[model samples]
Target: MNLYPINAGNFKLDGGAMFGVVPKSLWSRTNPADSNNMIDIAARCLLVEDGNRLILIDTGMGDKQSDKFFGYYYLWGDDTIDKSLARHGFTKDDITDVFMTHLHFDHCGGSIQWNKNKTILEPAFKNARFWSNKDHWKWATQPNRREKASFLKENILPMEESGQLKFIGLPEIDLLENSELGFDVFYANGHTDKQMIPMIRFKGKTICFMADLLPTAGHLPIPFVMGYDTRPLLTLDEKEKFLNMAADNNYYLFLEHDAHNEIITVQHTEKGVRLKEIYTCNEIFN
Candidate 1:
């Protein structure tokens, strides 16, 4: 199996929001903010090439939102979803599965697009089976007030309407109980309800997609939970357990939102589990 890093592009978000309660004087060193106090973030996605199945995880924010809506998050970079896929000599039609970690706009917004009729929305990958959990599907569709802004309907509804949407597995199971998808699902609730983190078993090693749970290297600390998380305490618990396991087993964390680091390994330190080594995906795999 081969894995490719897909750069959907970059966008700007408030450093304060990204770091939560972490003091600016500290986080600013790594993620320097602009005059407006917004830090540049990468909308990084992952592509899995296994046999005939080319699975794309998390499509970056698509190009369908209105000018006013996009004004808030300043989108930048020339690397688009199509161009990124093409970089690997592939296209949207070659994708057989779109494994969405969650339904947030930055994560799944590119799953759909606007057609010739401005009013009509359609699946971005007409031939791909878009994968999301049943519970997450409901949570995003009938989103709560706090998360409603992030779960845009334009990014979601079209998949089901196009008859290409599929649920991975049962939500209540310890593991993703009914997920027909081949990968093992690590259920994490700290970021959102039943956010499925895919643990891909390849070449006798486990590579975890650290979707929002550990957004960046800076977030490895237990207290560095995102303010956007619905349950911060639950996130603390999940991170502690997951990080301990990752450290013990030497799992490579494939960061989704980290602007610089792509993969990292953690070691149990006196302070806590801290980053031991930072390397790109190919460096470890090759």
Candidate 2:
């Protein structure tokens, strides 16, 4: 199996929001903020090439929102799913599965698109089967007031309407032994309910797609959790346990939102789990 990094684009988010209660003095060292107090964030997705199934994880925020709506996030850069896929000599039609880590706009919006003339919304990848879990599907569809803004309907409803949406981890199992997508699935509830983190074993290495569970290397410390989390304490617990195991087993973390760092590994230090090594995707696999 081959893995590739699919960079959708970069956007700016408030450092305060991204770092939660952590002081700017601390997080700014790793993720510096601009004059407007915004930190760079990447909608970095992952592509899995195994046999005939080309699975794309997290489509990034699509370019369908109105300028006013997008103005809120400050999207930048020329990267798009099309350009990223084309870089690997592939296209939307070539994708067989879209494994969404969660239904947040930045993660799943690219799964659907506006048709010619902007008359209707449709699945962006015409031939792909979109993957989301039942719990997250409900949590996103009937989103709570706090998270309502993050879960955009335009980015989600079309997948189901198109009859291409498939649910994984239906029983809400700890680890989905066989997802039928050639990867084991684990759920992290701290960031959002039932956020499925895909654990892919490739090239004799265990690579985990860190989808908000550990957004960036700066968040390696257990206390550094996102304010957006519905349950911050739960996040602490999940991160501690996950990090301990990751350090012990030496798993390569594939970050989704880190702007500069592409991948990293953690080791148990006196201060607890800390960043061990950082690598670009090519540096580790190529």
Clashing pairs in 2: none
**Candidate 1: C-alpha RMSD after superposition:** 1.6
User: What TM-score does candidate 2 reach?
Assistant: 0.98
- Candidate that scores best on TM-score: 2
TM-score of 1: 0.95
In order of listing, the candidates' clash counts read 4, 0
- Residue 81 of model 2, lDDT score: 87
lDDT of 2 at 96: 98
- lDDT digits (tens) for residues 99-193 of candidate 1: 99999999999999988787789888878999998889999999999899999988998899899999876645545433355678888887899
Instruction: Tell me the spans in candidate 1 whose CA falls farther than 4 Å from its real position.
Output: 171-173, 176-179
Error of 2 at 42 (Å): 0.2
Model 2, 1-286: lDDT tens digits are: 8888999988999999999999999999999999999999999999999999999999998999999988988988899989999999999999999999999889999999999989999998999999997888999999999999999999999999999999865644577675488888878898899998889998789999999999999999999999999999999999999999899999999999999999999999999999999999998767
